[model samples]
Target: MKIKDRVIELLSDKYCGLLPIKSIHEEDTIIDIGFDSLRFMEFVVLIEEEYHIEFPDDLLDIQSTTTVREVIERLEKEV
Candidate 1:
């Protein structure tokens, strides 16, 4: 699946549909989409497992304001 689709799926599952995936925009930050620190960390873990890549430690410093598009861009670079 495309990275964006997979991200939506993972988040939708994790949040139990609390997140309205269809309403999310590429530029929207995780916090803007209702993800707190714990939820974001869980999402990161899912991304790591799905891509079979360990994110750099510096990634943990990513701001909550980081956009979905930015995250996808970073993941694509890793791939």
Candidate 2:
């Protein structure tokens, strides 16, 4: 699956079960979906494990308004 799809899956599983995975748009911000600091941290860990990558602490400063597409683009650059 594409990174975006996988992200939606992970988010759906851990955070937002009320929304269907397909309903999530890449342009949507994390805050728009109700991701708090704790959930965002969990998401980062999940993404790291799934992609076998260690995200830099600096990257954790990502704003709640950051889009999924933006996050994916950053991750792709890291890879």
The worst-scoring run of ten residues by lDDT in candidate 1 lies at: 11-20
Candidate 1 regions off by >4 Å? 13-17
| lDDT for position 40 in model 2 | 75
What is each predicted model's overall lDDT from 0 to 1? 0.72, 0.72
Which residue pairs in model 1 clash with each other?
none
Q: Candidate 2 overall Cα lDDT vs. reference?
A: 0.72
- Index of the highest-TM-score prediction: 1
TM-score per prediction, in order, is 0.79, 0.77
Pairs of residues at least 3 apart in sequence or in different chains that clash in candidate 2: none
lDDT (10s digit) by residue, model 2, range 1-79: 8776676887774453335677667788867766767777888888788788998676686586787678777777776
